[model samples]
Target chain A: MTDNMYIERSCRISENTIWLDGAPYWKGLPAASFIDFAKEAFRLLKVDYPKFYKMDNLSKLVFLAADFLLQQQDKDGIALVMANRSSSLDTDIKHQQSIQEKESFFPSPATFVYTLPNICEGELCIRHQLMTENIFLVDECFPTETIEMYAAYLLRSGKAKRVMCGWAELFQENYDAVLYLVGPNGEKEHTKKNIEDLFR
Target chain B: MVELKEELKGKIIEVLNLEDVTVGDIQDGDALFGDGLGLDSIDALELIVLLDKEYGIKLSDPKQGKAIFKSIETMAAYISENRTK
Candidate 1:
């Protein structure tokens, strides 16, 4: 049996700047509080949820995602699978700059540890305090088959009754995210396949 | 001095994106950080740049800025002392 589940809710965010090989122009987008940014992320997915702040970049994203899933899904044993291409280029650059500037320069532990693109899942799980299976993937494009494969594996394994598989793609400057919830009774109208079909 | 305070108020509003605060709202010694204008560390850095760029006074240590940046009176005093402009 597979243990993969599909998305129940989703969100996406995009900025006007091009993410060619580095971070966005910090001045391009309107200044946004962390909560406001999460709100906008959810707005892109056409979903709704509560907002809170005081988290660093990765933690903040995971916090909102877990919060959304908890409110909508009553089931436990959930998995969070996410995808991002360049990992955390923003923090990586910051770390390198610190090292290059001075002999005694110390790399920020916080920034260095979160440089992995997949750590976003662990951040979300830690926030939600979820001990379920977590996974991360890096891909060139947001492909449906990739997510569908992992999610199906989770459900069949019976390790998790539900899965929140999210596709978070960040190009040079463009970002798009889509999350799906799939489960045992997922064949119903509100299932992941149905939502994906609408997009098609 | 009053005109100087007024001019400083205008600059602060323009630079900080205070949005709703106005000259009338900011007393001469009213706190500019934390409880006053809700200015945080980032805003403090911006204000530091403002001092250097506009007044030609550079502050390498941000912690030192807390006291000197108390209000219009304090900021004006510091700028008046070190301002190359």
Candidate 2:
């Protein structure tokens, strides 16, 4: 039954470019920074969510990738299993810097809220109206095996109709995301080899 | 009063990262939260930090934010009276 799960769609964001289903979807300026790329991509996608402007960099990256992958699909009962290496280090550094100096210690709630990596998943749930199970893992690299196993379990256990799984890593100026949807219908089966190939 | 209102608007935009919103778009009487600017609780917290860092005003009670953050006009007025720096 686990083998019945298939890869419905895939989207990747890295090197200031977006790739969907193994084809280049959008490319930003070569010299643009990650923030520049995110902002430009948001405008290009015409996303109407205003909270996107306030999200930390990691959340923004995850939101963009998930938004791209989940488009035109029924979003009901979709669980999320996301992995990242940095684990919100980007915002943690900012928070640490703000509190390091006693004289200038002022940590805003906006920045403090994103210190946890899983807040990115929370943002996705809020945006997509998904009230299903979600898991966020910190790994040195993409945990393809773990994701596939967990996604299969969720699908087999009847916990979710579909599972959105992938890796979204952002530390400092470096960022990369590979998100794909898994469900009962698709041409490609959800396997370690296929997931790894899609990530690459 | 006018100068303080304008300054508060700029700081709000900068601190909240309202990239799509300009200071000119925020009216002095417009609500800062809910339907007007659509700001949420996180923006409220940022504004608290902004008041402390920039105006030397500390909000010890969270409930006070409801009145102080009602609008740019209220915020400017409160800062004018309470700001130590």
lDDT of 2 by residue, A55-168 (tens): 999999999999889888899999999998999999999999989999989987898999999999999999999999999999999988888999999999999999999999
Question: Which clashing pairs does model 2 show?
Answer: none
TM-score of 1: 0.52
Runs of candidate 1 exceeding 4 Å displacement = A1-7, A13-58, A170-174, A186-200, B1-85
Error of 2 at B68 (Å): 1.3
- Residue B9 lDDT (model 1): 85
**Native-vs-model 1 lDDT?**
0.60
DockQ per candidate, 2 decimals: 0.05, 0.88
* Model 1, native contacts kept: 0.00
Interface RMSD of each: 9.5, 0.8
Q: Which candidate leads in lDDT?
A: 2
Candidate 2 segments whose C-alpha is farther than 4 A from its true place: A1-3
